[model samples]
Target: MAMVITVAIAVATELAIVGAGPAGMAAAEVAAGHGVEVTLVDEQAVPGGQFLRQPPPQFGVSDWLGDPVYREGRRLLERVSADRRLEWIMRSSVAGIFSNGDDDGDEPFTLVLNPVGEGDSGEGGAPRQLSARRVLIASGCFDLPVAFPGWTLPGVMAAGGIQAFVKSQQLVPGKRFLFAGSHPLQLVVADQIVQAGGSVAGVLFAQSSSRALALLKHPSVLLGNADKLSQTAGILWRLRRAGVPVRFRQTVLSANGTDSLESVTTVPVGPDGAIDSDAAEEIECDRLGVCFAFSTSSELARQAGVDCRWDASRGGWIAKHDDNMASSVPGVFVAGETTGVAGSDIAALEGQVAAIGCAAELGKIDARQAVELARLPRRQLSRRARFARLLSELAWPGASLFDQLMSDSATLCKCEGLTVGMLRTQLGRHPDIRTASAAKLLSRAGMGLCQGRYCHFALTRLMARQLGVPEERVGGFTSRFPAKPVSIGRLIGDDS
Candidate 1:
């Protein structure tokens, strides 16, 4: 059940921070230390974001993330939850943020909040609107949707989604699991499943072991992230002891089953990135967990008129920010993976810098003090940035390379039930279709219940290549207000 928060929004706050993960939590800590009044909101019921997602207080759950690997996150959560200065509005989402057209910079933004889950009474959002002098968007990222053969099967799931089930719900959704992808995230999720006493068929990587090792052996990666490296090594050791096979240069060709996944076809990829279908191996597993990359949740920022750019290696359509993490628009700031797909450590540092920047902007602190506070976090961020670049290279598997995995009969838009051939026919019918929005209207690809989040990545790749343009030129779906779906009952509910 959602936590129905009773918000009294009679007055405006000096700063409003969205997301309660590392970035949002860390920012609130700094804001409190600097004596700034903050309204910290999160879509989750708890403080932890995706990386440190914790179960609700009433779940009677404990010690899920208590492992040594998550020590830093645990410490941060403890500090932030104990902070009384920060006001929280949890289990709710920001529908839209509108800037006052006038030049009055003081409290110039209005935020519309709507209750989520079944607990909401479906009243039209009126009294829920709140005012803020500044806004920090730290909305995180989600799994990169890969539309391949039989990807929409009932038993197929994103690797991160599987991890969430085990971590928060303490329930393994499937008995047997097969993980396949380019990034090491699959390895981590597989280890979690194994620890949860779930059967694992195997873990496959598209890249060779040598290439991944050389990147891990980088001096910067080794020195700056010793804890992270240690945790990864521990997870690998556990997986090996559990008798889980970890293979290299291997990828999933397709998932075959009647109604749900009963088996998966695995194919070996050569050093030149060529798939060897003649030596395909069939692995029986009830679940297929695929982790290619991540897609940032920057729709709210974009809807607020913030500028964003695409970098397929990182989370796509990321908000552009300056040294202080301030967005191009005045009085609006962003941090964490929404800025890019860096890890939580880098996100926390960026959050501190953004908080101090906000304090300076709102006159709670002097310019010199803000610089002094941000200097250390900025220095730490630069060191982490070097390692993040190396990881990006490993995470990025060009969309064209997916041709070997996805077949023409594969469903492109699960929401619309549109197949790859259907989309291709639409593209072929209209040679001038270049942008994603055009492709959406022309082919009806991203028009569905998911609002294109699931299909947009795949659609952008197809449209960009067909039109001979970059994904950036293809542009993302037009970020509309009410970024999340609201019920018609709520829309017409009496404001009184």
Candidate 2:
């Protein structure tokens, strides 16, 4: 195997964090406070990640949509900024991670960083290299795509995508909107739109109110998360006061438009989870927002040869981590969504735990001290994780929802323009192709710019349903280095 070429150009640090989101920022703060030299890197120009994405500095927008979480994020960003030992690499992405140690021992991790905007004057925008004794992966999660008829319409977008535009850029996706998704986060997004002076036509929640209320069965979990409950309830109240129709057990069956999204068809889901087509209703709207759940952005962890397994509650395959957030790799640690689909609170705690683990492993803190430092965070993590599990169960998409929404003509792989009919036909013609990876080889389903991030979960479910197997049997595609596309010039180095 090719090894990470360590040259003089590479900067060295005691700890290197791949993402500057909540988990990463928290991890950097803790490590730096403990006198460790740390480097924090993120793709965005800001540090808040997706959950707490901030408006651009020039936007002059002081209102954080009346959400307290954003205020907390601002404070976290300030703390990260004031840390003298923490180095911030903004507007850049980690192109690849290279290390070789299967036989010899743990090797120093070398990360290739590619600038996001404005090409550096050099061959392939010559990437900078960072070598670290210990690495933490907190790459976070992305919006899960739901494939349905007319979903490729110009005005249709993922709910989280719409929120990102509204929150980070202060740009509304459309004048009038309809939100349909499995998670309650969609309602939160709708609240944002309304708060931003935009109109929402309606909100369709896939899970019924009774199903959601079932979470209350774990009273301690619900009571422990009283703050989150209050926030959610407040958002719901605002939507109600704004006259936004929030309907439960309803999902968008299709989107329709000639040039852009003009209307959407929705149907009530019965107790059995099948769409009650007899009660289908068509509502006109300029834009449609849809999402089911989120999948962990674990490409970097996978690239590092970390062990992973299919986790349904987490939305897909996740890197395996222990109580200390240490991954299968000796010197590499993982936290936040990269490990699983827990929310931002759990992610922050995980980061602190990972930092403690790293400090102890590096001899900066003794084992006893590390254990003492990790005790409270570990307890908090367990409590939050239990509540997260309840939330996941409540928001879990019904298998029948996919069957009702996705038609044979609906596009599955947007990057390759592959439709459901095309995929089904391919599977029928080749019975031997059972797994998603095998289907990718035959049909090019996931061989596009996204590298299957958008279509992997949907494709896996489709394949599993067709083959009468569990979703786990149809595994995800094997991730490769430079997970996202980078200029060829960067890969070859700046010879000029």
Candidate 3:
């Protein structure tokens, strides 16, 4: 690294949105439209969120408006990019949000970012730091992957990640692939793989029609925008037309492979949601796709000291926000899946609503306008939340998922390489030490790798079940400085 000094300019960078996904980008555009200066930062080189992915050039689609949600998302990004007041900073991450000093005599957020190498980095080299008066967090959710035996195999990957790779880089892991998981994603990925010149061995669905029936009770999912339903049906039709085997009510109990994934042993569960031994079978395949679904992006909000609660129906821990998407912490706001998992449409609406609230806070927009813009999403949220809740209840991961976790195998901390037995031993005689901090004190599960992203939910679930406490009653993991992993060298920057 070399040393250099750049002039630091002070401007009206009123709001900083942390993700370029639909929600975050929408917040920036809407806020800027209301006369506020906004900065939208994302780790990706482009603005589309994971769901509204823009495939690589080799894929032959300049703009694939295959679905209605994607079409609208693309339009939104275009509008945001065209706006002069909205600054787009790609290839940067919001390491942490701090209110440490008076910049220009104004108390604003201090954001730390790191830039990576060429292709991976949004711009070019290392990350840079900036300041903003108001901060809006919309860092979208990441897929939750539960490790199975032999899951460490090279050919195994999360379905969402695989789809992202196919869309972003026009790359496929293998020719023959097996995608097994909850509905929508399972069929969607299976169809994409086939379209991408990959062979689908089989589609093992962990959900059944019984769950789908429950999913329909909520009217919002029923009144789903025409585009989403079309895409969902199209994927299902493609899988059926391709003659791909579809296995329902089955889940991967274990992955069997020496070097890579050679086979997957699946257990077919009965209507009662227990594995039926008689229906268990082994499926041979070179690639395996597994997903435990997705969790919220409440890490930043949690780190900012906002109040959070666990809503299993909404997917993991979510921030406690009002109708306006304002967090408990003043001058801070949250939107999209980070608040809860309600799919893309709802996330977009929430993002827009958050922007309106932000405008009101900055005196750029009136409360009446904010209220009017927020109504549709509130109604949609109320209408479909029940059904989402039902589906979540039905799709809840069973306690058996972790029952057999090898005591000596990697546990609490995936990045730091901590193990379960080590964590258990650290608790010593404190039998009631069940919080994330307690687990961290014992074995550093939430302290390494993702800084609690991967293990936080699992740990909370396990502790709640073990102690017979309600999930909502359980507290969340506490984070420290450098909310994300940071290098000492980067902190010192050119001064080094």
Instruction: Output the number of the lDDT-best candidate.
Output: 1
lDDT of 1 by residue, 1-496 (tens): 4423334344578888989988898999998788888988778888889888897787976567766656777899899899888898887788778898764767799777776664454554433566898899998888888877889998999999999998888899999999988777787789888988998889887878887555434322321233456666787789889899988888888888999999999888887888999999999999999987888888899999889999887888999999999998888999988898877777888899999999998888999998898999999999888778677777666565676665688888998899888998888988888788888888778778677888888888787777788889999999886777655455444334
Clashes per candidate, residues 3 or more apart or on different chains: 0, 2, 6
User: Which one wins by lDDT: 1 or 3?
Assistant: 1
Per-residue lDDT tens digits for candidate 2, residues 295-355, read: 8887788888888888765758888989889999888899988887877777888999999
Candidate 3, 330-356: lDDT as tens digits:
778888788877666667777888888
Descending-lDDT candidate ranking: 1, 2, 3
Highest TM-score against the true fold, candidate: 1
Query: Considering only N, C-alpha and C atoms within 3 Å, which residue pairs clash in candidate 3?
Result: 91-122, 114-127, 115-126, 115-127, 412-445, 413-445
**Model 3, poorest ten-residue lDDT window?**
218-227
lDDT of 2: 0.81
Model 2 residue pairs with clashes: 124-489, 124-490
